[model samples]
Structures are given as structure tokens and as C-alpha cells.
Target chain A: MDSARDEPVLDVRGLRVEYRGDGRSVVGADDVSFSIGAGEVFGLAGESGCGKSTIANAVMRLLKPPAEITAGSIRFQGRDVLALDGRELRAFRWREIAMVFQSAMNSLNPVLTIGEQIGDIFTTHEKLKKRAARERAGELLELVGIDPGRLKAYPHQLSGGMRQRVVIAMAVALRPRLLIMDEPTTALDVVVQQEIMAQIRDLQRELGFSILFITHDMSLMVELSDRMGVMYGGRIVELANAKDLFAKPLHPYTEALMNAFPPLTGPRRELTGLFDAPRTADSCGFHVRCPDDRSDCSANIPDLREVAPGRWVAQSAQGAP
Target chain B: MTHPLLSVRGLTKDFQVGTVFSRRRVRAVDDVSFDLPAGRITALVGESGSGKSTIARCLARLEQPSAGQVLLDGEDVLRTERRRASQVYRRKVQMVFQDPFGSLNPVHRIEHFLARALVVHGHPATGEALRELMTTVGLTEDMLQSYPHELSGGQRQRVAIARALAVRPRLILADEPTSMLDVSVRVGVLNLMRRLREERDIAMLYITHDLGSARYLADTTMVMFAGELVEGGDALAVMDAPAHPYTRLLLSAVPDPERAGSYDPVERARLREAILNPTSCPYGDDGTCSRTEPVRHIVGEDDGQPHWVRCHLRAPASDIARRVLKATDDTEKAETTAA
Candidate 1:
């Protein structure tokens, strides 16, 4: 019941990530900016190579070599995440902001037992004793609806759904303010997906944790999130409340994404075109694919601008957002 | 009304799992039967381990059925010779897979895929005719030279559809074709399949777990539960007025953004529990409901647009059970109250 609107739990401004290799640099996240409040589910949606994941990885400061956070600031609870030292970053990582990777099944160590993996988090962060960590891991397992006794079992022993639950349990072990999940249920069945989603919703209500949910499934994003941001070619093109975004998608790319998903209700309509090839540096990312594409669309790159109250769209040359 | 193009009767598949010494027969697909009318799409929907995929594999001859009859033009394909069956079935039926990226070979150009099928099936005999087939599936002449990796998920699936069409197959079995693509691209693929079915007059077996997409493409839909067709009929009818408890539960669980603001956590939990335990219903194992399996029944005498449902509630004899159990009160009340 915590009001995320009071103050943002996590804030990012002019966030830019770039991949540098062989004396060349490729912009992965270009001036990405978004904020998540406590207990809010903020969705980051885009197609592959759209830089949504880059922003997520950058926030956690987990971007590996070749992928560098070139510019912008990430503030977790008003503290500059970029300013944290190695030891401070390690302590800040999962304790304050935990992440669940795309494939939750693969995220867990196959060789180790679920208990040991979760226990390691407590041992490293909380500096708890072996017995204390094991007990805490059991409690975490129980919290996620897994039998505490099953904590001794290996990841492969559990089904895809159960494995995901285990990953979620581990992620929420420290009761992090913000939990980043990148396509968590993409691998599971719909029935299991519904179950997992419900679990997350229930847990969020109980624990009062915010989420940065990332996926290509816009429908799922709309279902689970409080607010959503649409990404296209390394830019946050549009951001709005989940309901408003689905109701009136502002950006052309956002409109295309909404049109793309087959509605669960109503008459069926054919989607006419596929996403266009990524544009060159000089052109707008969505220029070729946009239904409203004009000569100016190809000539200039658009920037995110607030066209309506609490809704932002990538501004076009015609001054329409 | 035209006769069904493909009719499956008493289809069953049993897999031998565990050690050879103590082998156990797992009935992956039970005695399932359905009719696929020409130019109509029939969806085989179920969760994983529900034998939907097993049935699809059996239909495609990728996996041999332990018991069943696949009648193609009223000829039992299982009884035919291996070589003759392969040749006859290949031209009669073609398959499109879920993973568009995996279905096509990364090393091969998109043209090679369609060209090989065209040559083998004896369609598009001339080079000019082959290129035209490609154009029909919305692929340009330039894309023929592009490799699978170079193309997007939607484009790769289009190529798959094009390859299937090259054989001039009357039936297309698309096993979760759009599930792997981005949501934006998924509709485009589904729309393409729908267009192909309409233009070519091809019967399609569209398999998916996503009910939203199922409602979009299928003319008639089958809801599979624990390897059994628990409910099926007109797609809109089955979706809107889902008869089986499982089907209703599945439909209710679908995340509707409109209703997301007012979701009841308790009701969601109840539905989740019901879905997890498949044997909760009395009709699950009882022979009374299983004997006739309750075929399509006309609720009203108007147009005879009868909707089929496999639940015992639709059976006349189960009136006692319905009143005693009062299973559908909530659903029926909701509908009548809404009206």
C-alpha cells in the first residue's frame, strides 16, 4: 500500500550505455530516462537490440566489458549508483536492487542445490553463519510457496515454473526496494505464467517492493505494470500509465506495438507490416516502419517529449509527440 | 456444408518412459478425435504435458501414433506404405513450427528452402513460377537471397509458410508458430496464416497455449486437458462461453489490461488451484461422461448453430450431477446477470 508517487524509489536521467570495441562505439542506450516508485511495477518493453535490457543492466551496474555506461546518472534512493566503489557496489547490488535474468531456469547454478545458492546471498551480504544462511534460505523458499524441505533439491529437479519461483525467492531474499525481472515468465506455460504473475503481484503487495519488468510481450507488460515505457532502437520513445498507454498509445512505434498484439477480445484484424530494419544514425529509428513517416522522419532523430499530462512521446518534426 | 478435409478418429499415442526392464506406458495423447473442415482453422489448445504437441506431432507423422486413423481425403494414412505415405502426405499436409528461427537452417538462404520444396513437390516448375509463389506469401524477390539469420522472426515465419505452400498442401499444421516472436510481430504472422487459409482454401491446425491468438485465428477451437479434448466448438463460442471448468479457468486467467485495475487476488488463487489439479472434476475419470463425451448440443432451436462442449454439464443425464455439484453457477449467473 506504499504510494510510489510520493517519491521515486529509483531514478535515472540521461542514461546512456555504449558498446566499444576495435576503436568503434555503438550506442546501446541513448539518453534513456525513467523512474520507478516503491511498490510500482515499471515495465520496459521493446524488441530485441532495442536497448531496454542495456538500461536494466546499467541500473544494476552489471554491464560487462565492451558494454560501458558512458553517460547519465542512476540514483537509487537519492544516492548515485555510479559513485559506489567496488565493495560498495557489491553490497548495493542485490541487497538494494536484485535482478532476475531472462531464463530463470538457467540463472540458478545447476550443480549446486537451491538452498546453497540462496544461502550464498545471505552469507556474502548479511555475513550470516552457514546455519543461519541455510535457515534464511528455507524461509525464503517457504515465502515463494516452495516447500522449505525442497531447498535441498537441485534446479533441474524442479519444473520450469518451480525453478522460476526459486529464482524469485532468491531475488527477494533481502527484500530489495527494486526487483528487475527481464522476461521472467517467457519460458513458462500460460497457466504457469498466470500463476507466477499472481505470485509476484501478491508478493509485491506483501513486501512493498518495486519492479522493473522487461519483456517484448506488451500485453503481459500492460497486465502487470503500473506504468510502462516503450523502447525503440536504444531510446525510451514513450512512457505512460499502463492503462493509458494501451488505451491511447502516443508514439507511432507505441501504436504499432499495440496494434501488433492480437487482442484477447473483440474482432480480429490483420497487422499489415513487420518492424522495419534499424535506421542509420542520421535517421529516426522508427522512420521506415512508422505509418506516419515523412521526409523529416528520415532526416532527423526524435527526442522524448511530454505531449500530454503524465505521457511522453518521441517528438516528430511536425511538432507532434 | 462441405465434408471435413481431415478427420481423425480414436487418435492415441503412448510413450515408453523409464528403464527398459521396468518400462511404463505413458499415454501422451488419449483417444482424441476431431474433424478439420476445409478452409477452416482448428486449434488444438492445451498446456505443456497436456499432449497437444504430441497430437500435432502424430498428425504431422513426426511421431507415429500408437492407435488412431488419420483420414486424408477419406484414406487411412497409417495403413499406407512408408514411401507412398511420405510422398502422398507431404503434398497433402505441411507443418509450420513454433520457433521460426530454429525451423529454418541458418546456413541456407531463404530461397533454397522454398526451391527445394517446389522441386520435390513439382510445383513452380519454371523459375518464374517459383518466384511468384514467394510473392504470394508477402516475401519480395530480394528476400529469397537472404539467409534465415538475416531475416526477422516474422519474415522467417513467412518463409516457412511460403515453403509449406510450395508443396501446394491442402492442410497446414502450425504448431505455436507465433509464440516465439515479439508480440508486435505475432499478429502479423497470425494474420498471414489467416490470409493463406482464406486465399488457398487450406485447412489449418493452429496449435497454441495463448488463448488470445487462438481466438484470433481459429474458426473452431479444441481445448485439451490431460491429453483429452475437454471442450471444443466454434472459436468465439468456446472462448466467450467456455463450458468446461478448465476452459473457463483458462479464459479467466488471461491478463486483461482493462480489468487489471480491479483484479481480485482471491479469485485468481482459486482459479490457479483448480487448473493445477486436473482430477478435481468428477468428469475427469468417470466413464458416464466419457462414454458419449457430450457432443455439440443446440441450447436453442433457432438456427441449429449448435456449440460442442465435452463437459458432463452439457449432458442431459448429468442434470442430477449439475444440481448436486452446482459447478457452473458462478459462470451461468455471471452471463445471465450480465445479459
Candidate 2:
């Protein structure tokens, strides 16, 4: 907990994003805010289309057309990331921060060898000699617990899990201070997912780098993250240390999400998630589905406020005490 | 047991891979046998390529089994040759796939989807029948006008389930039905299936890699590894005290906040390269395991029931070791009831 008080590696506030087209539009993120302290793992968790991935894209400045960051301030080492121009932004994109994408099958270059694909980053960015870049690629593979001898193997030759390990190795090739992993293990099976998560945590600990781990798997997030933020309908409903959030979820949406997963050890209780259709953006986003929602829940949007020493909940019924 | 509604006797399926001349046989479902008792959910739990899905396809006759028979009321499904009889067989058993997004026809309305299923099964495709199935799946009649793309993932899955029910299946094979759904909506689908089994008395074989859902929704849990039924018993017993090493591995991988710190990286990497060969035990095929294929050993049976396991390590015998194993199992049962 002491490390959270230190200077954050990435600070995000009032971040809002939208996907606009001809007649239809969506509020992808509304007033989402969080920070990742040095050497800390901050998990952003939600179900599909809850805008966790949208936040990751906003951080990387990788939003495609029609999806724009409407309002927000992202500070990396106290530098305004959104204010940076072409060259400064390009330099900051991968050097200061690295991203491991969600689907490893599409992330890797299919035609290139693992060594060539990884070495190209060093060759283009750092301007290292060809031989030196190849050596660095081997080191990256070794760090991820892969045999460096597989450097010459093509992506198709390797299995799905091995391809993801290569992607992680490439993401950490430059040894960036902060890394953003977007559902890194969502596509892998359970055993392979745990192995990849363990490898990523080991790399983070060894390098002393902060990470923003984003995923929809709630139990996985709690196990691997130091602190977590729960998102629902494009808004963060609660934020707290991982253990506290699991122990006592203050927000109604958070409670529902926790109960959605079947218990591995406890007595089996029937799960009750959202019963109705998702609500619109005008109201408290989860009001329609919340089991305990009141008429006041739809009156005004609840601002995310600190409710305890280190816990925060965005609900009309809870606040700082 | 009252006669099994659907009994699979030595079902096997093999696919030929590689070029025609150099073709090699890959046994997808190898000598698998299980019973779907009247209305119980028999969960076939395993990792990928463990032949769970293949068994589901075999039950529905989507793929011809290489050998063996699917018995319904002591008659073989394969031996029945007439087209009308086969149609009756299909009407008795229907399947629901994993991907709800891909399962429904994009261009068809919900009404058209369910109506077609009824018509194909020789029932009148009337508005009354369509509304009945929709209400059973907890969907409003207004959704009948909407396309498949307009519905949420959970709703679309319900539409698929409703169509399967339109045929009035005696047995439903749901192959990873909830895996593609979000964690929040997955439980709703499970609840619907559970209600179907209880109210309609429709037998279900749920094929999934996740054991957490199995224990919650299934009455019996059957563990499959490398296309072999490794262990099976009552759902509570299989989850609480998993006898086979592969079953334990699958249960341990489930993400539980309470069991967070028990995962070891070294152990995970070792289990990552799981069993591939059809004949060898996944843990390690010592000489006998590789040569003499093991058979099911009925371990414990109290009150005229059996806890069956297919493991070379532990065999049921009247000896000191068997007594020790039995003693620990009693303690496990006590702990389960206490919890």
C-alpha cells in the first residue's frame, strides 16, 4: 500500500471516449479515472463493451477512426500525453510505454520469423547492428522462459501459448517503465492463462515496472492485481485495493459482478447478474440492472468518491464517512 | 439406475489427417462410454482436444461414429436406416453449440428461426407455439420481430435454446454453451438449462472445460483427458476430491480469489504440456500404463452407488492402502457436508 502513495507512473483523469458514426453513437467511456503507481499492478475489470479496452486504446493513442477521446488528461511522468505533437508522441508511444495486445494470433506478423519481428524493433528504434539486434531478441525470448533456439521458427510453427509468450517478450524488449496489457490471456486456456500471468508478474517484479492490466475476468484480476477498478456501462463504479474490493464490494454493480462467478470453495449459491437490458448513458449506467437501485439512482450520475481510507465507490448511497 | 435415457456404448471417432497417401489416423473420441440418466445433467469436463465435443456431435449424428452405438431405449441409433426413423431420432435429440453469435441465422427473425425448427420436426409453426418457446426461455414476444444481430449475446443463446426445445428433444447436447458468454450473463443461461431439466425432465450432456460451472449446474461430473473417461461420480464428490491428476489440474486452474496463492508457476508449465497420446496416462505412462491400457476400478460404493475412476495408480483392493484411501474419502465427505 505504501507504494501507491509514491509518484504514479501513469495518471489518468476525467477520461471520456466516444464512438461516433452517421446516426448511431456510443459513449465508450465516461469520466473514467485511475492511476498506476510505480511497480504496481492496476487492474481495470469489466464485462464486454464496458470500455476497459477503450481505455487501453486511449492510453496508447491507438483509437481507430470514429472512436475518439473526447475529454481527458493522461499524464506520464507529469507530461501531458494528449498535448504532445507528432514526433514527441511517436517517441513516447513505445519507448516510454509498451502495449501487449489482446489477441496474440493477430498481433504477431505471420510472414516474419520470431527473431526478425522482434529484432526489427531494436533495429529501427535503437539503430543497433544486425548481429546485436538478433542477440537482444534472443535475450528477450530467454526472459520469457522460451528457448532462444526457437527464434528462427515462424509463428505458425509455434503453438497458441508460445505465440503469446513471443508477444510478451516483444512488449518488454525495450524495458519500458510502464506496460499496458489488454486481456493478454483472454484467448488462452485456463492452465496456459495462469502460466502467462505468472510469467508477466515475474517480469514486472524483476524489472520494477508498473503495469495496467485490463481484462473482463474478475477473479483473475483480483488474484493478480494490487488494486482494481470495476467498470460498468462505460463508468467506473468502484475502486479499491484488490483484496478489499473482493471482501466487501460497496457498489451494487460490483456486488452483482462478484456473485456472477460460481464459487470454487464456498457453498453453491445461484448467481444473480443483471436481469434487464443495459441502461442508457443519461442515467446511472447500471440503474436498470441493479437489484437495489432506487428512484434517486437515476436522478443524477454518481461521482466516484472516496468512501474509506483507501476505498472508493460511485453510488448514491455511499460516500466518504 | 432406472434405464439410462441415452446410453453410449464404446463410441469412437477417428479423422484422417495429412495427405491421402501419407494419411495418419487421429482418434478424436476413443472408446468413450457414458449414460445420460433420465433428466440429469451429465457434464463431460475436459481440456481442448479431449473429445468432449466429438461425443456431443456423435449423439446428434452430426458425424458418423467409426464404431459402437448410441442406444435409446435399447435400440441402436446407427442401425436404424430408414429416413423417417432418423428424423424421429433427430427430433428426440438436438444440440446447442458454443458460439451464440454464429449459431443463429443473421438474416432471420427470431420468429422465423423458432418456426422453422417446429416445421422441420413436423409440428405446426404457429404464432402460439413461437410465443410459448420464447416465454419458456424468458424472452418477450416483441423480440420475435428482431433479427439475431439485434439481441444481446445472452438473448441470442436463449433463442438458440428455444429453437432446440421447439423439437421437444428427449436429450439436449449443449457443447460449451456458456463459454462465449460474459461471466455476468453466463449464470442466467445455466439457470435456464437447469430449469429445463427439472421442469421438462430433458436429459442434458454439458460439454465444457470449466469445472466450476459443472459442479453448480450438473448432477454428475465425468472427467475426460486425452479422449478417455478418467473419473466420474456425483458432481460434489468429483469436485471435492478429484481422484485423477488431470481432473485436479483442471479444477486448480479455475480462477478463485480464495485459492489465489496455491498456483505454482513450475507446476503450471509442467501441466501446460498435457497428455496427447491416446493410449498413455497423462501423468506419466510408466511401463504398464503405456502397454496395458487401464480399466475402470470401482472404488467406493455406499448405499448401492459407485465412485468410478480410471487410474493406474490407485486400484480398489481389500488391503491396508485401500482402507487408508477410504478413510480420507470419508473425511472429505464430512468436510463437504459441514461446508
DockQ of each two-chain model: 0.51, 0.55
Whole-model lDDT values for every prediction: 0.80, 0.82
Docking class of 1: medium
Candidate 1 lDDT, B212-300, residue by residue in tens: 78888888888887777877777777787777767876776666776653434355455334333433444344432322334444332
TM-score of chain A of each: 0.94, 0.93
In candidate 2, stretches whose alpha carbon ends up further than 4 angstroms from where it belongs are: A1-5, A20-25, A109-116, A128-135, A148-156, A288-296, A316-321, B18-23, B81-85, B264-291, B301-305, B318-339
Extract clashing residue pairs from model 1: none
Which ten residues in a row are the worst by lDDT in model 1 chain B? B296-305
Q: What tens digits encode model 2's per-residue C-alpha lDDT throughout B1-339?
A: 356888899999999987878989988888988888888898998877778899998787888889888888777878884222488788888899999999987988999999999998899998899999999999999999999999988899999999999999989999999888877689999999999999999999998877788988988889887677889988878888788777777777778778875666555335434444324444654323444455687766533446688765666443323333344435553344334
Model 2 pairs whose backbones collide: none
Candidate 2, A75-111: lDDT as tens digits? 9878888888888977887788999888865778889
